[model samples]
Every structure is written in structure tokens, then in C-alpha cells.
Target: MTAFTSHFAFEFRTGIRNKNLLLMNYLFPLGLYVMMSLIMPGINPLFQATIIPSMITFGILASTLLGLPDPLVQAREAGIFRSYKINGVPALNILLIPALSTILHILVVATIITITAPIFFDAPLPVNLPVFALIVVGTAVALSGLGILIGVISPNARLTVLYSQVIFLPSMIIGGVMLPYSMLPPVAAKVALLLPSTYAMNAFNSLAMGGTADFYAWGGLLTLFVGGLTAFILAWYLFRWDSQNTGSRRHPVLALLAFVPYATWLLIV
Candidate 1:
């Protein structure tokens, strides 16, 4: 317990202390949030209603995708995991402690956006406060799972960026953050069916805010839960203690199973 706490504490500090992590986890997200809050409402009169949720979603993307993955890959390359194993730290703990720390950072950032958006930008808050909090954590966990999974599967830091951006850029563009799901073209909307942010924004809009969901709002949250579970399970199965010393490994393509819940929902509905 003591060792776990110490490791957790150190990881939490890293979320703020490491320059890149700090930028992605705090400065980048908050800066973008503020920029959007200041400029967007003026551009789209309807933007205010969605600002809180969208920016909060963007913060999750920044914290998890931009902030989370490369460290794990780099650590593996540098033999950090090898040292941890020598000292008996479980891979589960190695993976989870950083994720938990990132989750904390996101919740704090989410809370900040939820509160300040209303006051500073006249952004609307969720009518369902408890559900809002629940879904924020839900989104955090779901996306963080993807982030860790990316780190686990990526062979190097460059590929980590590729994988993270594959989700990050699309989420920003079409995942119901910057653009409303309603306004997207029919084909683009279909493309969004595979993105977790689409579910997250739908949940926040329909279940928490007063907006209508493109799909079943509650069901979207459930999909996120299943998706997150699948991701963590896959991460555990594929975990390598060191980049060079990995034994027989599962094909990284198997990680796509994490999207089964999302794809299933897309097919069913």
C-alpha cells in the first residue's frame, strides 16, 4: 500500500511536472477551452449551450490522448518496466497508477470547466448534476483506456502520436465537440459512430443537458463502459515489460476488439 501510494503520488506529480504532460494535461486543454469559450459563443449564437460539455470533452481528449501515451512507450524503451518487474511491481499497477493519476487530472479540469464556463462564458451547465459527474468520469475512464492501450501497442513514440492523432483530430472535428452531431453531413455522422467522443457528447447532451441524443443516451454510456473494460483487458493481455524482451505477443490488431461495443451499437441502431 505504501509503495502504491508513493508511486501514485509520483505519477500524479508527473501529470503536472513533465513539460509535455503538463502542456497536454493542463495548459493546452485549458488554453483551448478558454479560447473556445471566448471566441466560439460569439461565432455561433447556439454554441453557448454546448460549450461546457464540448470543452470538457476536449479536455479529456487532450489529457488522455495527447498527455498519456508516449510516456508508457518511452518508459518501456528506457527499461522502466523492467526495473519495476525486478522490484515486483505488477504490470497492472504500472499501467493503472498512471491512468488513475491522469483521471484525477481530468476530473479536476472537468470540474473547472463545468463551473467556470457558466460564470465566465455564460455556458450552460448540465441539469442532471450527478449524471453529469458520472459521465465525465465515464468518458475519462473510457478514453484513458484507449490511451494506455495505444501506449501498450505502439512500438515507439512516433507511432504513439500517429495512433493518438487518429482519434484526437477526428474527435475535435466530428466527434460532437467542435461541430454538433446534428449539423454533420449524413456520411460524416456515420463516421462518428465509431468515435467514443460521439457517445460521450451524446450522453452529456441528452442525459445531462436538455439536448436530444442522436442515439440512446443511456445506451451510449453503457457502450463506453463496455469499451473501456475491453480496452483495459486487452492492455493487460498485451502488456510487455520491456520493448526488447517481450515474449510471444498478441497481434496489435486485436486491440480493435475494444471497439466492438461502439460498432455493435452502430449496427444495432
Candidate 2:
């Protein structure tokens, strides 16, 4: 427990030291929210309220899955993971650093959203604060685990950047960051449902729009829990401590597995 806490602190510090990443993790989402507020001044307050939560979730997703992994992959390639492994650090402890940092990042961002949300928009406070907090924390944990997994498996920094952008941008845009789910086309809506961000948005929207909790929020929480577990298992099986050591050609197979939960949700929900 001490080791986990110590490593978590170290990782959090490391994240703060990276100025560009720090800015993006902390400010980018807020910037997006502010921009949207300014550009669409005439939109309903309820719709604007939903945007804040969507942007918060997007911030969580970006920091964990996109911004954090690229450097981690590069560090692994440079023998950082090996050094830690030899230093009597457990693999799980090594993973904890980034995961914890990402969680902290989410908390700080969420706090900012909570404090400023009422000022910028007249959205009501969440109906069930405990459940809302749980969804935020759970989503962060699950996404952070997946980020560490990506760091372990990505071939290179370039690929990490490429892959993260490919996964994150469309997910954020279509998952109702800038546009409401109700406004999206049928096919686009179906595709948006296939991403975790959709669940996050729905959960947030439920809280903001009606001050009510619903199954959509629960579904989002479930998707994060189950999807994150699957990613962690695959990461354990597939992670190579040394980058020179090529992993199984099973990368595509594993990728498909990662997509399954969201895809299934799209089909059924």
C-alpha cells in the first residue's frame, strides 16, 4: 500500500512537470467548454449543462488514453520499465503510478467543473451526488488502466499518437462533446454509442437535464468497469517489458476484443 501510494505520488508529480500535457489535461477541456459557451450563446441552458459534463469526460479520456500514453510508451522503449522492474517494483505498482495520476487529474478537473458549472450555466446540481461521483471515479480508473495497457503495447510514440488521436477525436466529437446526441444522424448515433464517451455523456446529461438518475448512467458505469477489466487482462498477457522483443501478431485480435463491449452496447442499446 505504501509502495502504491509512493509510486502514485511520483507519477502525479511527473505528470505535472510536463507543461504541455499539464495544460491539455487541465485546461483544454475547460477551454472547449468556454468556447462552446461563447459560440452557442443562444442554446438552452440544459443543453449547455450537458456539454460541461461531456467535456469533463472528454478531458478524462484525453488525459488517460491519449495524452498520458505516448510518453509512457517511449519511456518503456528506453528501458524505463526494465529499470523499475529490476528495482524490486511490482508490475502492478509500476502501472499504479500513471493510473493514479490520471485519477487525480480527473478529480481536479471534475472539481473545476462542479465549481464553475453553476456560474456559467444554471444547470442543477446532480440528483444523486454519490452516484455521480462514483461514475466519475470509476470511469477514470477504467480509462487509466486502459491507458497503461496502451503504453505497454504500442509499437512506438508515433503510433501511440496516431492511434490515440484516431480513437479520441471522433469519439469525443460524435459522443456529444460539441453536438447533442439528439442532433446526430441515426448511423452516427449508433457509432457514437460504440464509444465510452457516449455513456459518460448520457450519465452527465441525466444529472443535468432532469436532475434524475437513469439506466443510461448505470450502463455507462458498467461499460467502463467491464471494458477496463478486459483491457487490463489483455495488457497483462501482452505487455513486453522490452520493446525489442516483438509481441504476438495478436495485436489486432486484442484490439477487436477491446471494441467488443462498446460495439455490443451499440447494438443492444
Candidate 3:
């Protein structure tokens, strides 16, 4: 436990030190919001109220997809993971440190977006704060789990960055961050339905607009949690502690389990 705490502390400090990462995770979402707000000035309030959750979702995606995976991959390539393994650190503990830290960073981003939405844009506060908080926390956890899976399977930082984009970009676009699911074409909307963020954004937008939050929003939270759990389980099986044998030994097949949550979601919705 003490070792875990020490590792967690070190990871937290490391994350704080990365200026570029801090900028992307902290400022990028706000910049997007600012640009969108300026362009849609007349409908800024409604837009702000509607898209704040989407922005927050984007922040979560940035933190988990890009933030956690690249560093872990770099560590593997740099032999840090081997050092930890030789020192007798538990695998789960090793993974948990970054997962927890990323979630913390995500929450900070969520808070910033939530508070600023109302003050700066005259956006409506969530009608149900508890529900909103639950969804946010759940979304953070699921996304972080996805990050772990990405980190474990990626052989190096470059592939981590590439794969992270492949997953994050599609999820963000289809999840309703860039546009509403309703506005998307039928096939795209169906694809969006498979992504957890789609439901999360839908729920959040509904709550912000002062309507009864759709059951799908809560369902989205559930789907994320379940999917994230599956991803972590698969990651445990596939996790690589070093770059050695990375290309030949990867268990990309196991990664498919991560999609179970989406499949379950199809059943629900």
C-alpha cells in the first residue's frame, strides 16, 4: 500500500510537470469552447448549455486517450516498466497509479467547464446535479480504463499516439462532441449509438436543458462502466512491461473484449 501510494504520488507529480500535456488537457477544451462561443454568439447560451457536457467529455477523452497511454508506452520503451517489475511492484498497482491520476485531472477539467459554462456563457446549470456528477465520474473511470488498455497494448509512444487518435477522434465525433447525434446521418447516428460518450452527452444535454434526463444517459454511464471494466480485464491479460517481444507477443485479440460494453449498450438501447 505504501509503495502504491508512493508510485501514485510520483505519477501525479510527473503529470503536473508536463507542460504540453497540461495545456492540451486543461486549455484545449476551453479554447474549443471559446471558438465555438464566438462563432455562435447569438445562440451561445443554448449552445453553451448544450455543449458544456460535450466539452467536458472531450476533456475526459483527451486525458485518458492521449494523456495516460503515451506516457505508459514511453515508459515501456524506456525500460521503466521493467524497473518497476524488477522492484516487485504489483501490475495492478502500476496501472492504477496513472488511471487514478488521469481521472483526477479529468475531474478538474470537468469542474472548470461546469463552473465556467454558467458564469461566462449564461448556460443553465444541470437540473440534477447528482445525476450529472455520477455520469461524469463514471465517464472518467471508463475512459481511464480504456487508456490503460491502450497503454498496455501499444508497443511504443508513436503507436500509442496513433491508436489513441483512431479511437478518440471517432468517439468524439460520433459521441456528439462536434455535433449533435440528431444532426448526424442515420448510419453515423447508429455508429454514435455504439460509443459511450454519445449517451453521456445526450444525458448531460438533456439535464442542462431542464428536461427529465433520458434513461439512455444513465444507461450510457452503465455502458461505460461495464465496457471499461472489460477493457481493464483484457488489459491485465495483454499488458506488456517492456518493449521486448512487443510486436510478436501482443494480444490484440483480447482487446476486442473492450467492446463488450458497446454490445451490451446495443441491447439496452
Model 2 misplaced regions, further than 4 Å: 43-46, 207-216, 247-252
- Model 3 TM-score is 0.90
lDDT of 3: 0.76
Candidate 3 per-residue lDDT, tens place, 1-269, comes to 68778888877777778875676567776687667756664754446557567778888888888788877787788888789889998788878888888787778878887888788777667778887887788778778888899888876677888878877888877777777777788778767776767767777776544654434665666777787788877887787777786565656767867877776655554
User: lDDT for each of the candidates?
Assistant: 0.90, 0.71, 0.76
The residue-level lDDT of candidate 2 at 92 comes to 68
Model 3 misplaced stretches (Cα beyond 4 Å): 41-46, 207-209, 212-215, 247-250
- Model 1 scores a TM of 0.97
Best by TM-score: 1
Determine which window of 10 residues in candidate 2 has minimal summed lDDT.
Answer: 207-216
Residue lDDT tens for model 2, 184-252: 888888888766676666666674445443246677778877877777667666666677767466563
The regions of model 1 sitting more than 4 angstroms off are none
User: Which scores greater on lDDT, model 1 or model 2?
Assistant: 1
The backbone clash count of each candidate, in order, is: 0, 0, 0
Models sorted by TM-score, best on top? 1, 3, 2
lDDT of 1 at 91: 95
